[model samples]
Each structure stands twice: as structure tokens, then as C-alpha cells.
Target: MSNVSVCFSWQIFTMESCVLIILVAMPGVWGGAWGVTFGDLCALKGTSVVMNCSYDYPSGYSVTNVGWSRPHYAAASGKWRLFFLSRLPTPPVHFEYVGDYNGNCNLKIHDVQRTDEGNYYFSFVTTLDRYTSTTPARLSVKELTAIVRPSTVAEGDDVSLTCVLGCPARTAVVWFRDGQRVLKPVFQARREDAGRYYCAVLGQETVRSASVVLNVQYAPKNVTLSVSPPRGVVQGSSVAFACASDANPPVTPTAYSLYKDGQFVSAGQSHTVLGVQPSHSGLYRCQAWNNVSWRGVDLMNSTEIRLDVQYGPTYISVSLEPQHAVEGSRVNLTCSAVANPAADNYTWWHKRTDSASSSPGPMLWAGSGRVLTLPAVEASHAGLYVCRARNSVGEMSSAEMLLTMSRGKRGSQPHLIIAGVGGFLSVTLVIALLWYRKQRTHAERKPAVFGSGLGVRGSSSPATGDQLDAVYANVGTSQWSPPLATAAQDAASRSQRSARHEHELPTSDEAEVTYSTVTIQPRNPSFPPRTNNSRAPQKCGIQCLTLMAVDIHGRKRDTLV
Candidate 1:
């Protein structure tokens, strides 16, 4: 027993010398045979921590208790008091002593929190003595925080950011913006850089700082003008216009100005026009402005938009082609009007005018479409014409226009009159000729009367005697002869008497007549008149006997017996 005691004391002395050398090498660290592996440690909040520890003693010593302890401030005593924890039956849910009594003395803390930051000490009890570590294991619970030099800045201005830990320490830091890694923490501010930003330790990506927004001021961009009731703007209706823009500091309502056809109209974010008219239609635009500026200008203009106001047809008129139309010619009547959304329907009306009809005729449906075409115009097509133009809004009728059909070809009126006169003269001539012929025929049918006388002459030749015999036979009554002297004297007297009475003679008809007395003697006393009873002498003394009667009009008729 005395020898064992001597050996134990020798071992204790040697261990003490070794511990003294370790303490000189690493200052502020637990350097005895039983000590923690680290002097200080840092951990993020809500993370687990493990402390490696070990212990040794003299060969004859036996371990009785093993535990950990920390210092807490006691406000009542104005001093730091020690709080102890031991693994009695089991460790707490938040803490565990995984080491055994032989050598290992590892302590684990689950779900480390901000309150867990402090110094920790390990102690053990042996059958000989109780020992505690002189150096403590300091714990630092940290959280990541991001700091910006200026949270808000204008575009093109400089900005800086920093990642700060709750406790000051030398550690690498990384930055992120909107879940994307950032290469640098300092940059020139731009519109694209305005977003949430945070930071984390280099190797501990799970730790992050709260998000902060960076506002970047900029001039208005993408300015645009919008019209309410986008289409189909009609006259006498309300119209609305609104201006919008993209800006950091929104433009004020009073900062908008409206323009039409490059002329200033109104000032406001929105403009309203009541009872819109066709004159109000034009190109419209809006100007937007704010406190921000780009280059040298501050105002921005939107793209021009067209506002069209619709209206019904007006100033209706009809136009006719070939103003002087002739029969069998084509005619066209075109309807025209000034309107928005051009007229879709056209109607033609006709009112006939004629000599037989005194008053104007009722309107008739002539045709439809912009142009009324007369394929083959006739005299019946002559009338007063009108055209009506219509659209979705309203309709209007044109003034009356006259459509006249010309006789024959144009400029032929004088010729027609001359032809009519010639025809009248021809008919008069025909009637005169017929009447003259009838009067002449009636006069020719009348007979005239005159007194008669007979004469006979005898020839000495034998042929003459035969002729006398034939003449007696032609008389068919009796052969009676008178002495030559007596016959000649008697004939002469008769001739004279007939001549004197010829002027005093009258006709049974009421027409004047001329009487003539003819004496017949044989051409040669040998020639005699042949009689049908004598077997008709081969030749007669006279070839023909003609008596002519004359009227006072100088017309004549001849008789042969």
C-alpha cells in the first residue's frame, strides 16, 4: 500500500507538469488532461451544437459524478452565480451528455437559441477529489442581418450594402437579391436593381437576413393614352381619355396634359368630352411628368391616338350623266353625300311630268344602290328624279332634278318642223288633182245638138253611076233622084242656113256647145260610098265621117258614124 501511494503521487506530479506546458502553448483555453477541444464556438440560431470533451485522473481514482455548468448573473447578489446540470437518470430534451465515465465527455445542445449564448464549464467527481476546468467554452449564437447605406436612391446613383452578424467576428459573407446570388455589394443603382435583398454566411446558406426593398427613382417611361369605349364613337356622345405611365414616384393627377393635333386642349390625368362632334375628331396624345428627369427633359409624351367621330349623311346631292338624254340611250343617276362611315343604302324616286297630266305625279320607287342605271332609256323615263342616301345613323334626300327625253337626236327640232310642213303640202296637192279630174269627166258625158241638112252629087262616069246606085241602096228606102241643078241649089242653101243657126243652137245639157256642118262629095266623082246590099263596094267614096262638138272650156269630143 505504501508503494502504490508513492506511484500515484508521482503520476499526479507528472500530469500537472504536462498541463502547465499545454496552457502556455494555447492561451485562454482549457489545457489540463481533462478539457474541451475548442476554447470558443459560434453557431447560427435554431442550429444544434456539439462540444467535444475528455477527462483523466490518477490511476487509483474512481469517477462518481460528471456534469456541466454555466455562469448566470444574480441580480439580488450583484454577482455571477454558477448553475449546474447533471445527467442524473437522463439528460434534458434540449441537452444530452453522450460521453461515458471512462474518457469521452461530449455534450450536445439541440435547437440552439439566442439565449444559449454564454460560457460553459465541465466538471467531474472522483473518489479522491472533485475537479473543474479553469477555462470555459464560450458559445456565440448569431443571426444574419443586411445593412444598406441608403435604402432609396435615384437611378445612376451609387449604392452600398453590407452583411452584419449579431456578434462581431471575422467570417466570409455572401449576398443575395430575390433569391439570386450577387457578386458585389456595391453598385450604381438602376431600375433593375430595385428589389428585396438579404445576406448569409459563406458556408451557411440556410442563414439569411430579412428582406429589404430598394427603391429606384426614375423618369416616366412607356407612357400611353387609353380611350374609354374604345370604338364606335358617335356624334353627341361622351368620350373619355386617360393617361398612364411607368414611374417610381407615380405622376400626380395634375401632372398630365392632353393635346389634340399638336394643340394643347386640357390638363388632367383623364379628360372628358361631352357632346362630341365630327370636328372633335383628330389625333390625341397625353404628356406625363414627375419630379424625376432623364438627360435634360422631364416631360414624356405618349403615342398619338386617333379619335374618329361618326355622323349621318349630309349635303346630299344627285348627279346625272348625259344631261340631255335621248330615246334608246343609257342614263345614270349617281347619289352622293358627305358622311362618316359612308352611306350604305341609296334609293331613287321618280315623279312623272307630261302634257296630259297637269300636276306632278306621286313618287315612285325607281331603283336602289349608289347609281340608278337606265339600260335603255325611253320617252316614258322622262320625269323629275330624286335620290335618298342612308346609313346606320340617318337618311337624307337630294333636291329634285329633271330628267327629259329629247326628240330624235339632239338639235333636230328645226328639221322636224320642216318635214311636217313638206308633208302637209304633198297632201294638199293630191286632193286638188282628184277634184280637177272629176269635174272634167262630168263635162265630157254631156251631148250637144245642132240642125241638119243633106246634099247629093252625081258623076258622069260609069263608076259614079254604080256609086249612086250603092248610095241609094245604103239609104234602104227608095231610089229617088232629083235634077243636078235642083240638088246643088238646095244643098248650097242648106249649108248657109246651118252656119247662121249654128251660133244660136242650144244643147239639152246645160253646157255650151259648138255645132259644125260638113258637106260630103266624092273625092273624085268616080269614087262612091259603098252600100252593104250591093255586096259592099270594094272601096267607099269617103274613108271616114267625123263630127266634132266644142264646149266653152275648150274641151272637145268627136263622133263617128
Candidate 2:
């Protein structure tokens, strides 16, 4: 058996090793090049590495089919796939040449990548390996592409450019940035990846290539932008805008860079107010860049935005219904902040507490702030009212206006106490008079009916009966006392008692009463006692009763002496 082999160090480019050949004669001992060495190669990730294999077969042992594959490292097997004469090379397999079955075979990689490292085998349909099989060919790879770095990037401004490598990491890849060899990463990413980014590649055995271009994408991209006051930004006035961008390095470390009209005005600032108004205004924009990208992107773009200065509503107004209303009268109030373009809106809040309070508390006037149409004004609405006006730019308030709600004119006057009393007295008097008249008539109309043996009589005399009851009952009896009975013959001594009473009744206007005995002493003796007994003696209301004899005044006699 005879074999040829070459050896070299892992990472270093070394001179070719001396070849050695050993010859041996024995049965089943196959002789050929046991080891064909392919040195390590540098290439970018996601690219292919090829191991070209060629061989001469003995005349008696004709060739069958040839195949290439990574039998070991199952995980890397896909990355190191197979190329055969009969089938298309599997995934991770490059392009295959079918003509290899008769003798010629070449493997081509469509897209190369990292991780496709390890041993590869070639096979022929034979008795040994179902015809033929080779040990393996060892190949190594070195990364060829350059690293990229970016420096400080603003939210809306492009950060400076920085890069590690700009060249393809193959054939001794060369790095160049801004037209210079860059051994280390640059500080900032360039726009267009910069006409600046490129690399020159040298051939493994032939001529070198001119620098190639590298297009990079970095963090923080830009979006729409707008302003609250779109007219023209003024000095000492707040200006606002919106910014957005897409980035992997994170837009967090980014800051806003504001350019006024065209000149750099501020940085790391969004809500900006140029305290001092500049004289000009024009084009404006910003870009974002970071070490994450080889080229910078825009975080927020500058739309058409200008700044202008203006004033807001000054004095406000408040009106009360029925301009001349009385206290506690319902007052409709309209408090408005009159200014340019009116107000944005109005909000009304009472100076005091509301229904949530514990007492008869105050409440906010209802309506859209400016007009508070109090359905009904109460005493509570009597106070100072303040009108406030505000815009995106500023806010102002009006002087307080005093609002007085009155309880209108008195509904009706209070009735007099005397009138109330007089009414009650008149009612009482009427009742009294009616009762008196009724009693007098009733007594006069009644026919006397003596009990048992007594008689009944109707006399026209003013006092047919004792007139006592007429005068007494005139005032209406408080207590009606029955007259003392004279003679009640129907009963006992009571009959005489009743009789005396009965005879004592007055016959004429003046009644002659014969007491047991009596004598009269006139105020003037000249005027003798009236001899006409029926002539109604005495004066008014006098009563006369006819009797047997009378003795003298103040005395009762047994006979008419």
C-alpha cells in the first residue's frame, strides 16, 4: 500500500509540507492518496466553501457513481450536505455536476454560510462501499466580512459614522471607509452607507478586486411630524412636535435635534421655544444614526411648520336675567370669555361645595361654562363670578362680577291682627243676638198650661205671666232656674206655691202686687200713688198684678187694712 499526505498549522498561512509516499503489497490493501489537504479559507458568513476532489481509478475497476457529503456532525450535516451524480444535492448542498459519474465531479455552492465546517466523503458504487468510498477531505474557514459600529445618534438627527470592516472577508478581505483603510470600527454611520464604505478583495491565486460597496441599516427611523400652532413659531413661545423612528440599537439613547427654518437651533429638544426670535424661517429636517447601523436613518422628519405670536381672549362678560330683579329672584347668567376665535371650550365650577356637601350647599351653574343658564336662581347664586379663557398658547381670567339674586316683590301683604280679631268678635255677637231674639219669642208664644187642676190662658197683656223670665232670659240664661212654685193642688203644698206664682203674673204693663202688706214712699209725695191700678204703674218694664189688699211698704199684713 502507498499513500500521500500534507500537514500544516490551524490558523497560520504556512509553506507546503513535504509529500511522503509509502508502498506496500498485500491482499485487500487499497493504495492511493490517503490524505488530500485543503488549507483554511476566509469568507463572509452565509457564503460557500468548496473542496475540489479529482482521482484516477484502476482500469479493471471501472467507475460507477460519485457523491459528496458530511457523514459526521449531524447538526452540521445539513450545512455540509451531499452532491451526487444521480440526485440534486440536498439542502446546505451547493450545485452538483452529474458528469462526475463517468469521471468528472465538481460541487458548487449557491449561497454560502458559516457553520459548514468538518469532514466530507466521496463514494462510488463498489464492493467496498457498495462499490467505492473515500476517507475524507479536511477543509477550514475563516470569517471575512468586517464588523460595523455607530456612534452617538440623536432622535431626529443622524449620529456620526463608525464602522469596523467594509470589505468582503475573502481573498484577504480589505476594509476602507470614506476612501481610507479602516483597521478599527468607525465612530459613526454614514448616509448612503456613504460613498465612503467599500472594500478591496484579493484573489487566492490571481488578481485583486476593486473595493465593493456595503449598504447598512441602523437604528431609529423617522415618521410624521406636526405642530399645535402651525403658523410660525415665535420666540419665548412653546412649540411642540411628534417624532417616531424604527431602530434596533434602540431609539432610547436618541435625542431630538431641532433646526429652525434651516439653521441648527436646538438639540435633544422637542417642545422648543427659541427664547429670542430669529429673523428667518425656511427648510428643516433631522436624521437618526447609531453604532447599530453602518448608515444613519431619520427618527422624525420636518414637515412644513412655522411659528407666530398672538394674544388670547382678554375681558369676559357675565349677564343676569331681568337686569333689575329682586332678591332671591331667578337670574339667568351668561359668563363668556370673548376673545379671538372665541374660546376652545368652557368649564364651570362653583367657588363653593356642591350636592356632595352636608348642608344646603352651592352647585356649579349648569350649561357650557360660558353660559350658565340657572333654571332658577337662588340666594346661593349671589357671589363673585370669574370667567377664564384659555388656548393652546395661553390662559387668562376676567375680573370678578358680583351677581345678586333677589326674592322678587312681596307676593301679598300680611293680614292685620286687629282684622283677624274683629272677624272673630263679629261672629260671636251675631250668634248671641240670634239666640236672644229666639228665646224671647219662644217664651212669649208659649201658652201657659197649669198642671192637673190649673188653667190655660192667652193674654195680650205685656206681662200676662210673671215678667221675670223675659228680662232674665233676655241676656240668655247662663243657668235657667225654675220659678218658685206657688200652689200645685194637683200634688201637695206645691199647688198653692204654684198658684201664688200663677196669680203673680202681670196683667197690664204695670202690675199691682199685693204683697202680704206694703206701703210706697214716693221720691215726691206730691205725686200720689197711681190710683189707676191697670194704668201700668211705674215706668219702663214695670209689672202689675191684681191682689186683695195691701197694707204698707215693706210689710206683710193679714188683711187689706
Candidate 3:
């Protein structure tokens, strides 16, 4: 009973509630007329808390022992864990009983942790009954922590800052930059934003995390080029070059390269040339690069400088449009030379050759141009020619070229006349012979079919003392005919009859009725020439025919009427 009185009195003192108020408020809610009092408590982690309590017992009930237990929901079924028990010489290390044997109960807990959050109750043992406070004190513990996602990053990158706690309760998170409130949890980092950063819970301003500095790496920029002795460099003089750029984690010489006329020349931040030629006169440029992380992007800067050098002529050449020319033809000769300053003067020379002599002739002073022309060329123009080109730098001559006269048909009118006459005579002879052979073949193919002529179909007697009109008859004949006479005789007879027909001047109808005969001369010596056995003696030839007209006196008119 003494131990119970000591622990219960401590709980009552710490609670600080008046016992008379509870008794008047609730008359029989305590059931056996015993009551308990406990107020809620709130504290921070790593701090201490005091649970003030008070209680009452009915009359004639004796107390024996007092104990404090924690109701935890961690197990399957809720259970109470005894943390402080009276009758022990001293309270547990984390708990201390600080009240007397009266009804004032106060529980002190030191070095509070996050796990110390729950409801606590005080129980006391009496000789007749056991009493425990139905109303427990609710204790809450809070802790503040900070977390940074991806603490290190490059320039122009995004990061997040968060304030966290061991409990699931939501709270406002505040961020700080260089010990100043930023009021935001997300940070869009740039080169200028590289500094110390931290975070804290809003209500617990005193709690914070260790500061972390952000590292921002960036590529090279603001590239520039410089040259020593900026002007007036001779053709064979020396010169120096330098390149530079600005970047974080300062760019090294190995990251720089030099170019001449857009072509890679060397690798370095600086370069020197000992003997610069005119070929080196062009656009010179330098580039700086920093491709860390190589995002498949072009991260580089460049600058350029133009270099001019003075030089003399280096190459000379001569050309001719028509390398071979004929007599009385136009010709052109040109000389060309490559120099820093172009050539302005030119001269021509000739080398003549003959069947008896050859020599380098006098120089022809042409105009101050690159080309020379000879308009009306002749045999005298046949020679070896050369050209000389001159400028401020130097003078050079071209190789010699030999020009000669053309060998083609020129002047022979007599030979042309003779050839023309000979061709005409040969054609005439061929035509005469072809005509003779064609006549002989025609005579052999037509062996002259013999047929008696048919007189007029109806004959009418002429009237007395009347002038009779002449009648013309057209007779049709086949291609076959009878033989007339020997070839020689026929030819003689044809001549005679042609002469007679010319004298007589027969009409068209009578002349068209001329006889055609083809004779086959027998090669046997005994064969004799055939004779005409008709009633009248007719001209027996291929071109002769007898035509007559009879009157009422039966007189034959042998001539055409």
C-alpha cells in the first residue's frame, strides 16, 4: 500500500488536474468510485517529456503497488508493456517516478526517440481491487531530416530538394541557398547557381541538414585568334599564331587546333612557321573544343585570320591553236605565265628553214599582249617560232614549234582536161557496141513469120469520070515473121529502100507497114540464097513493103496519094 501510494501520488502531481473538479463532473462513471486523470503531451525527438497524472480511490480501499504501462498496436493483438513499476529501488533508465505517496502521479521520460509515440497509462494495486486510468496520455515524437536527389550535376541541369520525417505525417519543406530561404524545393541549376544548398522542415526551423555544394561543368566559349606582327610579312618571312577560349575547368592547349584555308594544319594553342611561301597565303582559322559527356553534339568555337604573301612568277607555258597549218592559212600563238603579279609584255621570234639554209631569224615586236596572230600566211611563213613573256618579277621563253607548208594537189589544168576527154570517149564506144549487139539479138529472136496480106473486105467498082479518094488500111501482125534475105543483102536493100522512101515521102500509114525479117544464114557452103516468088517483084528487105492503089481502069498507083 505504501509503494502504491508513492507511485499514484506522482502521477496526480504531474497531471495538475484538480480532484474536486473530476468528482463533481462525473459522480458514478468511475464504477467503484475511483478516478484517474491524464493530459496529452507533444515533444520533439532527442528531447524529454513529463506525463502529469492524478487519481482517486474509494473509502476503505488500501493501495499496494503502482505501475505504468504503454499500449502498443505493433503486435497481432494489442498488449501493454510495463515500463515503470513501483517497489523497484529506482525507476528504469528512461523513466523516473517524481511524485510522493499521495495521489499526484508524474512520469518523466528522458532522451525521447521516434519509437516513443503512443498512449501511456498508470495502474495501482489495492487490497480489494485494481485501478487503471481509462484516459491515457497521448505522446507524440517528431524528427526532421533532409534528402537531396542527384547531389552532383552539370550546368543547366534540374535537381530536387526535400525535407523528410520518419513519420507519415505531411509537412511543409523549405529550401535554403547560402543560408537564405529560397521558398522552393526544385532547383534549375546554371553556372551562376553553383553554391551551397540545404533544406529544413517548415515548423522546425531549427532543424537542418549539412550543406552541399553543386558542381556545374560547362563547354568552351568566346573563342578568339591572335597573330604577332599583325601586318607586313614578306614572302619568306616567319610568323606566330595563338588561339584562346573561355570555359569552366579551364580549357587546355590539347583541346585546340589550327587550320589553313579550312584544312587542318596543326594541333595546339599556338604555332609558328619558319619559311612561309605564297602557297601559304589563305584564310587561317583556329578552333577550341570541350566534348565531355559527348552528347553527339558539336560543342566547339572557332575564329579566323587572313594571311597574304607576295611572290614572283612560278610557271610559264606557250600554246598554239592549230599546231599544223597549210599555206595561206590564219595562225595564232599564245604565251601564258602564272605569277603573283601577272605578266604585261610579250615578244615573238622566228626560225626559218629552206632547202639550202636554216637560221634563227629576227624578233617580231608584237603588242604588249599574250597572243600573236598571222592573218595572210604564205610559204615564207614556214618556220620554227617561239614567244617570250615578261613581268615585274621575271621573264621566260616558250619552247620552239616548227611550222611547215601543206603538200596537196595545187595547179595542173592540162592533166584534168586529158582525163575528162578519155572518160567521154570510152563511154561513147561502149554505147555503140551495146546498140549493135542488141540489134543482132532481136533479129535472131524473131525468125520472120511469113503471111499473105488480106485485101479489102468489100470491093466496089469506081464510078465513071469520078475522082477517087485514097484509102488507108492498118494491118495487125504478131511478133513472128518470115526471113527476108541474107544479112549482107538485107543491109544493102535497107539502104536502098531508105533512100527511095526519103525521095517518095510516103504517108504515115504506108510507112508504118514496113516489113520486118530475121534471117538465119546457113553456114553450109552449098546452101543458096532464097529468092522472092510473088506476083510482083518486091524489094526483099526488112524495111521495104509494096503498097498500091487501083482505080476503075485497074491501074495500080504505086505512090502514096
Candidate 4:
């Protein structure tokens, strides 16, 4: 034992009789019996447990003499100390904080302690047959009795505390909440539910109960995620979805993911958008998370999208003007094809010629397949040309054009001018020759007088032939001039010569100056007629005839004719 003790003799106490006399235990040679009747009581921190104690007394003992003590087992002097006691008016000083002695002297310490286990002694006297009965009390103080409440409960359900009581013989059950006595059904304290609770009982010395954690679990039913703009959104637009459930906490940061075209677009804020172009169209779904412990769940099962793009025309053409071209002239070949989309490039083709074959054949210029243009004229340039235009969308070609050209003539203009001048001079010379010929024709006489008018001379007829010598002598050199003035002029041009015929044989007739001496024509047939010319002869065979007359100077005429 750990405490001081006092001894009391029990032979003086009677069972049935009692008086109000005090009998204190004195210092004794041997200490009072202190034993631990109930083993150490056990309990959790927030609950309660109990220990049991009891004693016997004879009749006729004074009831006021009972004294209960709980002593420390570590105390020297061999007894347990009185931490709790019970008595009547004016009981022992050690019984101040102990239990009452009026009826059942049971001890109940709220929130029992582990160090409370020790020896407990009861010293009392009771009145029965009117004798003074003194007795020694034996007490064994132990740890508080205890139990453990069940630790868990599901939410929205009845909660029960499975209280396991230690020291079953001495432990009693009492309900306490926040250090106050709470009335409940026999051993069970159930109120729809509670978070943490305790059980207490009064027994020998201590009160204790069990402490347990009441945990609850529940799931929110009908959980769902709402998608804003729920109607499948247009491609390239936006959508939102939020996961909502009836849970204890609704504002937990959850994940909302969306998928499309075999790709994940977003993982939060529910909606997924596929905006405007055709490529953006696809199927979509979403997964969400919240204040629940399950893995990500699909908020949306399936969705679809269709996006369309509208466009205008393409491949444009512009009509070229001037459908005909000359080989020498530079043709303005404008080939234009127009559409909503501009044409990117242009090509030119030739319309086949060769009508006889009935099959179109390419001309040389046409085979060039270039914009129809000819810098200079050539026979090969004659062909038809067409321009083709194209863009990404489509292609178009322009109408063909025919090119014609005249080959230039080859001549020297300077030679023509010289020839024209020489012809004019030749015509003037011929006109002058004709005028001179006409003038000469007018001067000639008629054909009846051809070869007439020779000079005639007459001399006085001297006796024929007798006076011939004398007559010839007397007619000395009287000359006859013939009409040969032009011939005479020809001889005079050589030298100054006398116009005289040879006078050798003309002595007789020549001295007489006789014109009859000239030979007359004997009809002139034997003369060969001057070898007649075949061409049309000149009409005036004898041209410019002149007559010779004698000029007597202002005197009587001498008849010489």
C-alpha cells in the first residue's frame, strides 16, 4: 500500500442496532486490509468507466461510524488513502469528497482516472440491538469501468453506440453529453444521431464511458451535368457544361472535358465548340468530375456537328476585241476569262485551217500557240488564233480570230519615171519631121511639065554652011546658061568657077549661042528611065523651079528670046 492506515476492531458493532457515535480508527500496529477488488477500469478519452466496492457491518452499530477511503498503493505505512468516502452528519474529515453513506454508498467519479486504482477501506458502526458495534472496513479501489462505442455510422441512418463494458460486475451505465447527465433507454442512448458521445455509471468509486467516432457516408443520387447552349453548338463556336450533384459539397473544382474528331479539346466547363468551316465538323463528348470519388464520368454520351462553307464562282474570262488580224499589223490579242475567283493563267490555241481535208490542221503561226501577233507580214502568218484561260475552279477559252495579209508588190519606181520622159521626147521629134515633108511637097509642079524649059538660042542664019565658018566666027562666045543653078552652086562651093558647059564642039552653035544645039529627047525610051523606084515617089520630082530673064537696063528691048 502507498498510504497511512488506521485499524479498528469489529467486535463491538451489532448488526441491528445503531447509534450516532463516533469511532475513529487509531494508529494501529497492523494496517487495515486494502485490496483491489475490481481490476483497473478502462475507457476511451471522451467516455466513462466504473469500479465496484462493498462492505458488511454487524447490527446495533452506530451508522455514523462508517468511513470509506481510497488510498494510494504507493504509500508507506501499508494502507490506501481515502480519496472518496461516505458518512452521516459530522463524518470523518477524509470523507469530504467521497460518496454519501445514507443508503447505498456507491462511488461514481465522472470521467474516471487511471491512477484511481488503489485500496479502499470502510470503517463504520451500525445500530441494531443498542450496543456499540465497531467494525473494520476493507476496500479495494480500482480504475474506472469503461466501454468502447462503435466507431462508425452511415449518413441518414440510425446510429448505435456498441458500448463494450470492462469490469462488468462493477460497471453501470449512465449517459452523459457535454458533462451533463442525459437520460436514455436502459443501456442505449440514441437520438436520431450524434457526432461524439459518452456513457457513465456510478459504482464502487469511479464513473467512465466509451468514446467513439460516428462517421457517415452517403452518395448524391440523380447526379447530372448541365450543358449550356445544349443544342449541339455550331462549329468554331463555344459551349459550356457544369457537373452538378446533390452532394455535401457542390463547389468542388471538377473537370469537364470535351472530345471531337478523335481529339480532346477541353477538360473543364462542359461545352465544346466546333466553329464555322467544313473541316471543323465532327462528333463530340464530355467527361466531368466533382465532389465524388469515382473516376471521370461522361456528362454527354454523344453529339454531332456539321459545318458548311459557302463560296462563289471561279475561272473568269474577258472577251478580246478585234477578231481579225493582218499579218503585217500587230494584233491586240487580249484573252480574258473572268469569274468570281480570278483566272490565274492563259493559253492560246489556233483554229485549224485546211478546209479541203475537212480536218483542222495547224498553220505555222497557229502552231506557235502564243498570243496571236505578227510583227511583220509573211505567208506563214495567215491562221486563226484562240486564247484559253483557266483558274482553280474551271477553264474557258475565247473565240478564234482569222489573220489575213496582202504580200507587197516588187518594182523599181525610179525606172518607170526615166522611161516616161524618153517617150515624150521621141514623139516631139516625129511631129517636126512630118511638117517639113509637107512643106517640100507644096513647092513642086505638075507631071505635064516634067523636063521642059531648056534654054533656047537663035542666031541670024548666015548662008547655010557657006557662011558657017564666018557665022561661027562672027558669033563669038555668046554663051547659053542652062537651068543648073543648084548644080552650079554645088561646084561654086568648092571654088569660084565659071558656070559654062565644055565649048569644044559648040564652035558653030556655041558661037551662035543657040539653045537648039542642046540635044532634045528622042522620046527618051532608051534611057532606062533613071531606074524607077518602087516606093511611093515624091510628087515634086523637080523641086523649086526657077526661070531666067534678060534684064535690058531701061532701054528698048532687044529680042534675045
Q: Rate the local accuracy (lDDT) of all candidates.
A: 0.71, 0.43, 0.61, 0.39
Model 1: lDDT equals 0.71
- Write down the TM-score for model 2: 0.28
Q: What are the per-residue Cα lDDT tens digits for candidate 4 across 471-545?
A: 111111233333334333433332222113223234543332222212222233453221212222322222222
| Model 2 error, position 315 (Å) | 13
TM-score for candidate 1, residues paired by index: 0.58
Query: Is 1 or 4 the stronger prediction by TM-score?
Result: 1
Compare candidates 1 and 3 on TM-score and give the better one.
Answer: 1
What's the TM-score of every candidate structure?
A: 0.58, 0.28, 0.36, 0.26
Candidate 3 per-residue lDDT, tens place, 134-250, comes to 667888887655565666666667878766665455556577878787765777766666667776656665555557776666666677878776875656788898998866656
- Index of the highest-TM-score prediction: 1
Q: lDDT by residue for model 1 over 1-561, one digit each (tens)?
A: 122332242333355534443443354543334333445777767556787777776566667777787776667888875556442222367778888887678888876777888888876665544466767888888877788768999888998998777765576878888999988899999888988998876787766777878888888989999998788899999999999999889999999999999999999999999999999999999999998998878999999999999899999988888787877778899989988889999999998888786898889999999999997788778999999988888888899999988776643456678888999999999999999999878865744222122222132222332332232211111134444334334444644554455545554433554433343454577764443234322333443323455657565533222
Local distance difference test, candidate 4: 0.39
Candidate 3's C-alpha runs over 4 A off are 1-154, 157-217, 225-240, 260-264, 277-284, 290-311, 338-359, 362-364, 379-384, 388-395, 406-495, 499-561
Over 277-390, each residue of candidate 2 has an lDDT whose tens digit, in order, gives 333334455544444533343344545455444445656666666675454344566666644445786645455433466553344543456666654466665565666667
Q: Any runs in candidate 2 off by more than 4 Å, and if so which?
A: 1-45, 48-50, 73-89, 92-95, 98-105, 125-135, 141-143, 148-227, 230-561
